[model samples]
Each structure stands twice: as structure tokens, then as C-alpha cells.
Target chain A: MTKPRQWIERTIEVGLFLSALLSVLVTLGIVGVLLFETVGFFKTVPLLDFLTDTEWTPLFSEKHYGILPLFSGTFLTTSIAMAVALPVGLISAIYLSEYASRRVRTILKPILEILAAIPTVVYGYFALIFVTPLLQKVIPGLSGFNALSPGIVMGIMIVPIVSSLSEDAMHAVPAGLKEGGYALGSTRLQVATQVVLPAAFSGVVSSFILGISRAVGETMIVAIAAGLQPRLTLNPLVPIETVTAYIVQVSMGDTPTGTIEYQTIFAAGMSLFLLTFVLNIVSYLLRKRFREVYD
Target chain B: MTPDKTKALSADPTHAMEKDIAFKVEDLNVYYGEKQALKKIKVDIPTHSVTAIIGPSGCGKSTFLRCLNRMNELLPNFRIEGEIIFDGQNIYDKNVDVIDVRQRIGMVFQKPNPFPKSIYENVAYGLRIQGIKKRDLLDNIVEMSLKKAAIWDEVKDRLAHPALALSGGQQQRLCIARALAVEPEVLLLDEPTSAIDPIATGRIEELLRELVKSYTIVMVTHNMQQAARVSGSTAYFLLGELIEFDETSKIFTNPGDRRTEDYITGRFG
Candidate 1:
């Protein structure tokens, strides 16, 4: 009974709603699949055993299923990556926002962005070939496939994310606040560090959280460079396997569908998802706090 | 159309000036690229008194205030000619450190722009940057500055609270306290009370009157009444030129320039 124009508008409205719902549906589907397979994984391996077991050698003749090794590996690499990225990215953002001229910023910003555009696979190979060999010369005991090289490479890869986002946050701070600082006779460095950085604290913290989440979920870089040995050790000189690397290794191999070993990837994925979800929540809370202060 | 005050000010730049001059601006010309913002400005600001610069928007009043602290140099393509003599040295001299100039001539803006920090930290920031790490000294200075700014009683209990939590007027007072913490010789205010409500504006005017007892104050304000109420002397500017400079009472009652009189009487901005 509707007119043609009214019908067309209704159709478009439905289509837009469907488009919005599609992403949410896909996310729910992913969570359902991960939960289903993780449940299947727990049927064979007890929860306590999965949590407490130190060795993660499910593929070997003697099987073990502790999540600790993967957790430790992921933790170690992410820590190293953060340690490298935090200072470097923050400093670059300060230079870009506070010190660099408009022309210099225009030139330098795209160069930093290009670092993000570089393929992770390329970075993986770079970690294995160039960085590892160089580190081997400097630190004699470093293995060919250790956590250090891949960690550093991953840090280099995520620098753009931290810098670009943090810079946006710093840029968002009111110019009036900075003017107030300069009026108080603060030098350029003091204005940047004391006023701008603190004012943009929530945004900067959000960047750090995002960078850590990206490092945790990173696959190819650690898979190719960091060896597939899931050992519960913090030593960067030794080979260690991250949760993502193990998932990648399992997904690539000839393990049959729904097998306990294959289902292990889903359980590992769930843990990764949960960790990133927690990080995102923390970032959201911090950003909310910032909004409350300013608004 | 008698231009008595204008002729006197233009003929002798230091006419009716106090012996203790805080600043001597001589042949000052400011340009932002091709456009001139301030044209051939010459005036002497006396110490320990409020000197209000009154003009319509874009008349270079704010530009003139910023020049005293060398804040104009921070902008792109901003150039200034002539001398701004402060502390017996030309602040525009190549060898004179800008940091030192700013330290001596602190400024406040139209809107209260407090840092997103604790009330205590906001006041203590100036000394902290100067590397004064002593806890007792910082505590003493923060208390003294807050008291001087007339916000100590309101904010004393909430020193740890965020500065942004305060009302707009309180925040302005906090900013004033922050500026006072550094103990600058001159405090430049660029329409500081324009953003606040009348009650807040009255509080600030009264505070300024109290402050002029010790520190030199140069403020740019659009409000003629505020200039009359708070300032000792008033400089009337029109189209980037100083039209008249005289006592606040004389300038209000009988302006020297026709432009100054017309603008003051609300005939035209």
C-alpha cells in the first residue's frame, strides 16, 4: 500500500540496519565458534591441567597442554615490544606535535605511516634474516630463532600506531592550555612534557593499550622468527612460542578437523581475544575519565 | 573633535608617565607576514599599576600585550621592529633570552585554561619546572600564591582535586594563582574576565585592584567600564594605532582623540 518513494526509503533503511548488524553478527559468530571449540578442547584436557601444565608439546608423542608457556611467550615478546615502542613512539609524537614545523611534520608523518603499511610477513623475514644475525654478532649466545629479534621487529612495526594515535591525542589538547604553559615561562620541552603530555594522558594510555594489544595478537612476525618451542621461560635469548604463533603453526599443519590438537588453536584464540578485550575496556575507561575532566 | 590627549601622547611618548617604568615600547611595528597588526606603537607602562589597553577586536591590543613577553615570536611569519625595553634591556635584542623575558612578564588569557592536574600541582608547576624540588618551599609558595589570588579558602581543602573540577571563575583565579607562583614582575592579561559571568568579572576586577599594589599589570580589554574601574591608565587603540594614552579618569571623562571618544561613548567601535 506504500508509495514507490516510501517503499524505496524503507528498503534503504532496512539495508543500512542490516549492514550495521552484519559486523555484530560476525563478531558473535566468531565468539560462538571459539567457545564451541574451546569447550571441545577442555573435554579431553582438564581445565586445571590446561592451566597448570608447563609444557605445550601436543604434537609430540608425549602430550602436555599447559597454557602457561604460550602465555609466558606472548607476555615476554609484548613486554619487549612495549618497552621499545613506548618511549620511541611518545618522543616521535612530541617532536611531531610540539617541535616540528608544519612542513617538517607533513613530510615526517607519512614516513612514519609507511612503517605501518609495510607487510607483517616482510617484517617477519626481516626479523629472522637481518636483525637476528646482527644481534648474534653483538650478543654471542643469542639463538637463531630467539624472542628478542622478533620482539624488537614487532616493536618497530607498531611504532607508527603508537606515534600516530598519541600524536592525534596530543594534537587534540586545547592550544589554550599550551599557551598558558608558555605564558608561565615554560620552555618548549617543559610545555610538551609537563602540559601537553599530561593533558593527553588518557589518549596516550589508550595508544599504549592498543599497541600492546596489537603486539599480543601479532602472528607472522613471531611465527617466522621466534621458534615454535613453547617453553616457560622469560629469557629472550631462547626460542619461545606465542599464543598466536602456536595457533598459526597448528592451523598450517595436517592436524585433522575437530581433533584435540586442532581445537587447541581455538582455546588459544579465546585467551588472546579475552586479553585484548580487557585491554580495550581499560582504554575505554581511561578515555572516559579524560572526557569527564575536560568536558 | 578636539584631539588634545592624542596630540599630547603622540608629541611626547612619555607624557604623564611614572618614573618607575615597567616597559618602554619605542617605534614598535608588528607584522604577521604581509599584514601589519601593530603600527609604530610607542608607550611607557608604569610599574605597580594597572595599564589597560582598550580597543575593538583586531585593533592589536592583544598583540601589544603579547609583545611584552615575546610571546608573539612563537607564531609563524611573525616579525617585530623596534625596541621593547624591559629591565633596562631591549627584550627584542637577539642575545636576550626569551625564557627570561617570559619569566619576568607572565600572562593570563580570556578563557581560564588550567592544566588537567591537581589544584596544588597547578600552582606548584612554575617552581617545579625551575627545578625547585624542596617540599617545604613548594608548599609555602603554593599556599602564598593561592592566598594572593584570593582562591585559597575555596580550594585549600581540595588541593589534591583536579583543577578542572572548579567553576570557571575559580579556574581563572587558579590560573592567576599559577601565574603568581612564578613571581613575575609584570602580569599581562588579555581580556581575562571576558569569558566569565559578571560576578566572576567583579571578583577579578577587585583582585586586580589589590594586585596592582605590588606588580605591574598590562591588560587588553574590550569593556570600557572595566578599564575605568580597575586600570590606573588607559591606552586607546584604533586600527592598529595608539590613538590616545592618558589617566583612566581623563580618558573616560574627556578623551583626547575623537576616535577614542567615539569608541568609548559607544558611537562606533
Candidate 2:
């Protein structure tokens, strides 16, 4: 009877272990497929030309396969997105965690989270129709389908991501630290700015980095709102194409499976994956290094 | 020996020291939301004396201590009624500034909560908040405060090290030094040594006894023996009420209330 019970427990433990193993295997399989396709694409298009060429016109008969223009466009949009998102999101987090009462926090936190839950495609249309037209009134150079509109909308979409994570980190700071500051005769603002913000700095940075990763990988908003012209331009007021947007553009159109044009999407996908993967790892490390585990 | 003798002793002018009262609480009642925590407490904390409030867990000792400095005001649902007079003025008055009161009356917590900063920065935080920018002045005050807390010699060499890197006792001493740097007239400690080891506790108790010479000290502790050893006066609280307050020796040896006796003698909490 004891042997049977031990056997039953062992079986259950093995079943749970197998489930965990399966998840890891599935992730590796996806990455393996991406790597295989990316390698095959790189063979057809010389690695240097794929990385260094400034123009990407895969649809035309004379296809020039340079990924630099796409990269520059992606960088421009993401930078604008971060510039808009970081400060607003962080301040909102600070306001929620430090200033708001419990009832207010309960009301506002869910509202902010709902912003994140909105479908990306809805934000896409809003940027294309409402934001672009509004910007066209103020700036003479603003295009009908510009990166600025989509970047601004993407920033709004990612605000909740940064605010929620940052709020959690700020809340995790021990109450004793704040009390210590108060007892030292520091004002509420002083305590929040000097002591609490500094203590939670790494967590805040991690949140910002995570937000940047989300902005970089974001697809639907940039695809619908920003024009699909991978021009190498720094001006956010002009139309630009991001890596995700390029992939979406290529995949939506008709292209044969064996064509080089089709493989370029895989190359862009690989670059996007690598960028976000590096960011995720760095954010994870920052959290580990700076987290204060108060006993 | 008795009340008559004490009165006679008080009559001597040269030996009769007249000290100002640091805190006077009259009919002070505290409530946390719907639950009453402190019930009509009336007491006077003499200036520059080590007074310890001793009781079991949840007996309102810490609550009463927090009320003295208005630290309880931090909680949104915490309510207090009645008067708390500090420095000859009612701290609860409408015109009184709560921030100024807190600045003058510093507090140390149960667990060591040194900011995640350098040792020098931790000691200099209070002064810095007051906008004191003179490097020489901050340096002198840091050294003096650390010396007063009996931690100067150990930490002087590692002034730039993180405060969190210190040992438990050293950290508590650092917190005491941090409080002292602001030159507060009174210091309220809530179980300051409870989270520390025995050696650190002993060091902190010794430091408290030394601190009573210049600053008024009010401490809440669950350890009765510690209260007796470190305090000049003792107050016993139980079930949200003050049971007895008197000389430390008398309270420990012959408490006026049976609840105080039961608690001190380990009969029941």
C-alpha cells in the first residue's frame, strides 16, 4: 500500500514537470523556426547588403533589399514614442502610488489598465483619422499618414504598461522608509522625490525599458496609421515604416513562398525579436540587481 | 521616601530643578476607523528624561507614542480627539503646523529603516531637507550626531558605504544618529530594538540612557526588563488604557494596578 501511494505521488510530480518542460520546448521550437527562416533569407541576400542598404523596395521588379532604411524608420518612431511615454507614465504612477487615497487608487488604476486593454487596431484607426487630421491643422509639413500620429498613439497605448509596472514597484517600497523621511521633518513632496523615487529608481527604469520594448514590437497601430514607405528620414512628421509595419505590409500582399521578397520579412522579424529579447533580458537583470527585499 | 519626603525634597531651591514639559496629553483618545485603540490617556513627558511605555502587543503603547508627535496623522482613517500640548503650546491647535511639530519631534522605528543611501547621506538627510548646503557644517553635524549615538568611531571610516550594508545594531544606531542630526527636542522610539539581536539591543539601550541628558526620549517596548533598565520613568498600558505611571523602580517592584502586576510578572498578557 505504501509503494502504491509513493508511485501515485511520483506520477503526479512527473506530470507537472512534463507540463513545464513542454512550455520551454514550445518557445524553443518557435525560436528555432525563426532562426531557420532568417538564416535561409540571409543566404540569398548577402548579410552586408541586407544590413547596410538604405532602400527597401521589395514589390517593384528591381527589388533593392537594404534593411537600414527600415531600421532607421523604426528607430525614429520608437524614440518619439518613448519621449512621449516615459515622463507622463512615470508621473501618473507617482501620483497614483504616493498622492492618491485608497478609493482614488481603486478608481484610477483600473481606468489606466483599461487603456492598455483597448484593441491596438482601434488605436490605429484613431491615430489615422483623428490625430493626423488634428496635427495637419498645426504643422504645415505634417503628412496625411505620418509616423508622428502613430508614434503618439503608440505612446498612449504603452502608457498604462509603464504606469502599472512602475506603480507596482513604487508601492513595493516599504512604508517604513516613507515614515522615516516624514519623521526627519521632510515634506510629503520631499519624501516622495528624494527618498522614495531614488529607492525605486531601478524598478522605474525597468518599466521604461519594458515600455520601449512594447513600443518597438507594436504592429497594428504603426501599420494602419503610418505609411508603409521605409524612407530613411529622422523627421517624425513625415511618413515612415517600422520593422513590424514592414512585415505586416509584406505578409498582407501576394508574394510567392520561394521569392527573396518573402524571405525579407523573416529577416525583419528576426531583428525585431532580437531587439526585444535583449531588452527583456536587461530589464530582468535590472530588477534582480536593484529589488530591495525588506524583511 | 514617601510623598511627604518627596515634597520636602522639592522645596529645596538649589536642588529643585525646574524643567519644561516636552509633551502633555490630556484626555487623549485614539481610534483606528471603528476600533478604539487608546482610551482617554493623560500623561506628562518631562523634558530630557528617558520615559518608557511598556505593555503587551496591541496594548496602545505604540499608539500613545505616535500620538505625542502626531505620527498617527499619517493614517487616513486614524482619528484623535482631545489635546496634545508640546513646548507650552497645544500641538493639536488649528494654527499649529504639523510639519514643524514633526521636525522638532523626531522618531525611530522598530525595524532599522535607513534609506538606501550612503552613511554620510543618511545622517545628513534631515539637515539637507532643511536646505543646509554648507559642506563643513553638515560634516561637523554628522560627526557630532554619530558621536552622540556612540556609532561615530565604527562608521567614520566607511562614511560613503551604503546604510543598508551596516549590521543590525549599527543600522539602528545609524537611525538614531540620523534623528539626532536634526537637533530635535524630543525623540520617540517605537520598539526600536525589537528587530535587533541581543547585543545590538544592549548597545541601543545604553545609547538611549546617554541620549536622555540633552533630549527628551519616549520609547515603547514589549520587553519589561529593558524598560526598567533603560528608562528613568515607566508607564504601563493594557487594553487601550494607561494602568500606571511612576518611577521605573517603583513600577517594576510595586505597580499600583493588578493588570500592570500581572503583565510585568508574566502571569498573562
Candidate 3:
């Protein structure tokens, strides 16, 4: 009986190890594929041109391969998303963490989480059909498929992500510190801003970084709403194509596998991966530093 | 009873005229939801003296202390009846600004809780919240407050260091300095030395004796010796009631109540 139990336990341990190893193997496989395809693409397009070229017209007859226009579009949309999400998400977090009653929080948190649960494709259509038209009424010159609409919609999409994580950070602040602030005659606002916010600063900052990473990696909303124009303009009023949107466009079209146009998606995928990779590392570092300080 | 008559009776008639009272708590009943934490408590905490509230764990001594500065209001389902009169006005009155009340009554907690900022920033925080932006003034007050807390000489050179990096004793003193930067009228300490070493506790007790000269001191402590050593008057609480309130000497030597005697001796808390 003991031998049979031991044999079963050994099998289970090996099975668990293999399950854990599968995820790492898949991640390594992705990195290897991205590297191979990117190197192949770089052989046809020089690294300098890829980095410094102002325009990206690979599918067009012109055949320019500069990654800058796509990068600028990605940066512009992400900026708008950050601008919308940061203050709104942070304020919501502060309200939920510092001001809201337990009952209100219990009711409100699920509703906010539901906002996150909505499909990104629905958000995409909403941006194109609803948000753009609304903005056109106000601004008059707003494009039907512009960066601003998708950018704002993406911001709204990620608000729960930013607010939920940031609220968790603020809530982790010790009650004694808050009571100390109150004992010194600090008003509720003063305590929230002065003491709790600063003590939870690193975690809040990490949450923002993660939110930005989500905005950078988001695909469906930008693909459906932000138009297929790889213009290197900061103007949110004009239609722009982000890196993710460009990949979706190439993948859906007749780009022909093993062609330079086909390989552009992999190259674009590499850039997006690298950008989010750096962001995740920074976020992880900040979170670790925060743990050292408080714990 | 009439308001005047209740006031006259609550304030010890023997010392009512002579004693300078900082707080006159009358029929202050505290409830957390349906459960009562403190029964009808009436006591006149005198000014410029250390008045210690001593009792066993879960005796509502800390709850009574928290009520003086209205800190109990932060808890959910917390309800209070009766009045805590401070500066001749009922602090719990609807017209009274809680912010203003808190500024006058500062509290030090059991564990050292300094903001994870520089020592200088922690001390200046209270003043900064009040919109006191003058740098020179803040510097002077921070120095004075730290000196008063008896940690200036140890930390004078390292004001820019993170407060959490300091020893626990120094951190506690930093909290004290932070509280003092606002120059509150009454200082409430809830087991301030319970988390510190014997040496640190002694230094804090010595600091309290000096502080009472300028600010009214109300303390909640479990250590009977600490109450006898630092406080002028002591209030013994059992369960949720103020069993006895009198001179520290009398309470230690000859308590008015049998329960107080039972507690002060090696009997059950």
C-alpha cells in the first residue's frame, strides 16, 4: 500500500512540474519565433531605416519600412489613454479606498469590474459608432475613425484595471498611519492625499505602469476604431494606425505568408513585446521596493 | 438633572473651583452597533497634568481615550451619546468642526507609525497640511518639536533620512515630534510605550512629564507601574465602567473601590 501511494505521489509531482514547465516553454517558443522572423525582416530592411524612417508604407507600392510612424501612433493613443485614465482611475481609487463605506464599496466594486468584463470588440464598435459621432458634434473636424475616440474608449476600458489595483495598494496602508494623521487634526482629504497616498506611492505608480502596458498591448479597440492611416502626427483628430492595429490589418489582408509584408507583423509584434516587457519589469521593481519599505 | 447641576456634580466639587479642567466628559456612552463599548462615563480630566486610564485588555480604556478627540467616529456603526465638553463647548456638537477639534487634541499610538518619508518631512507634515509653507518657520518648529520629544540630538544630522530607517524608539519619538509640530492643546497617548524597550519607555515617560507642563496629557496604559510613575491622577476601568478616579498615590496605596485594589495587586486583571 505504501509503495503504491509513493508511486502515485511521484507521478503527481512530475505531472505538476511538467504543467509549470509548459508555460515557460510556450513563452520561450514565442520569443524564439519573434527573434527569427524579426531577423529575417531586418535582413531586407536595414536597422537604421527601421528605427529612423518617418513613414511606414510596406503594403503600399512605395515600400518604406520605417517603424517610427507606427510607433508614434502607438505613443499618441497611449498618451491620450493615460491622460484620461490616470486622474479618473486614481480619483476613483482614492474615493473607494478612503471615503466609501464598506457597503458602498461592496456594491460599487462589482459594477466597476463589470466595465472590465465587457468584450473589447464591443468597446471597439462603441468607439467607432458612438464616441466618434459624439465628438464630431462637439469639435466639428473630428474624423469618423480617429485616434481620439479609440484612445478615450481604451482609457475607459482600462479604468477598472488602474483603479482596482491602485485601490488595493491604498487599502494596504496601515490603519495606524491614517489614525495618526486624523489625530493631528488632518481632514479626510488631507489624510488621503498627504499620508496614505505617499505611503502607497510606489504601488500606485506600479499600477499606472501596468495600465500603460495594457493600453500599449490593446488590439481590438484600436483595430476597429482607429483608422488604417500610419500618419506620424500627434494630432488626435486625425486617423492613426497603432502597431497592434497595423498587425491586425496585415494579418486579415492578403499579405501572403513568408513575404516581407507578412514578416512586418512579427517585427511589429517584437517591438510591442519589448515595450511591455520593459514596463512590466519597472512595475515589478517598484512593487518589490514598496514591499521592502512597508513590510 | 439640570445641566448646571450635572456639571457642578460631575466636576469634583472639592476641586472644581481650583482645578483647571481640559475635558469634562458627561454620560458619554459609546456603542459599536448593538454592543456597548463604554457605559455612561463621567469624568473631568484636568489640564497640564498626566491623567492615566488603566485597565486590562478589552476594558474600553482605549475607547474612552479615542472619544476625547472624536477618533471613534471613523469606525463604522459607531454611535455615541452625551457630551465631551472641551474649551467650554461640546466637541460632539453639530456646529463644531471636527477638523478644528482634532488639531487641538493630538494622539500617539502604541506602535511607532512614522510616514515613510524623511524625518524632516514627517515633522513638517502636520504644519504643511495647515498651509504653513514658510521654510524657515518649518525648520525652526521641526527642530523645536524634535528637541521637545528628546530625539533631536540623536537625529539632528540625519533629518533627511527615511524615518523608517531609524530605530523603533527614534521612530516613536519622530511621531511625537510630528504630533507636536502642530502644537496641540491636549496630547492623548494610547499605550505609547507598550511596543518600545524598557530604556525607550523610560525616555518617553520622562518626556511626558516635561510635556504636561505645556499640554494636557491623557494616557491609556496597561502597566500599573507606568501609571503610578508618570501620571498625577489615574482612572481605573473595569469592563466598560470607570470604577475609580483619584490621585495616583491614593489609587496605588488605598483605592476607593475593591475592584481597583484587586487590579493594582497581583490579582486577576
By DockQ, the best candidate is 3
**Clashes per candidate, residues 3 or more apart or on different chains:** 1, 0, 0
lDDT of 1 by residue, B1-269 (tens): 25965765576546555347899999999999999999999999989999999988889999999999998888999999999999789999989988888888989999899999999999999899999999999999999999999999998999999998899999999999999999999999999999889999999999999999989999999898999999999999888999999889999999888888899999987
How close is candidate 3 at the interface, in terms of C-alpha RMSD after superposing the true interface residues? Answer: 1.1
Candidate 1 pairs with clashing backbones: B5-B256
The 10-residue segment with the lowest total lDDT in model 1 chain B: B10-19
Which digits, one per residue and each the tens of the lDDT, describe model 2 over residues B51-89?
999988998998999888788889989998989989768
Candidate 1 yields a Cα-based lDDT of 0.93
Comparison by TM-score, 1 against 2, better one: 1
Q: Write the per-residue lDDT of candidate 3 for residues B72-163, one digit (tens) a residue.
A: 99999999999999989999999999989988898899999998789999999989999999999999999999999999999999999989
TM-score of each: 0.96, 0.92, 0.96
Q: Is candidate 2 or candidate 3 better by lDDT?
A: 3
User: Candidate 1: TM of chain A?
Assistant: 0.97
Tell the DockQ for candidate 2.
0.69
Q: Cα deviation of B47 in candidate 1 (Å)?
A: 1.1
Writing each residue's lDDT as its tens digit, candidate 2 over A84-149 gives: 889889889889989999999999999999989999999999999999999999998899888899
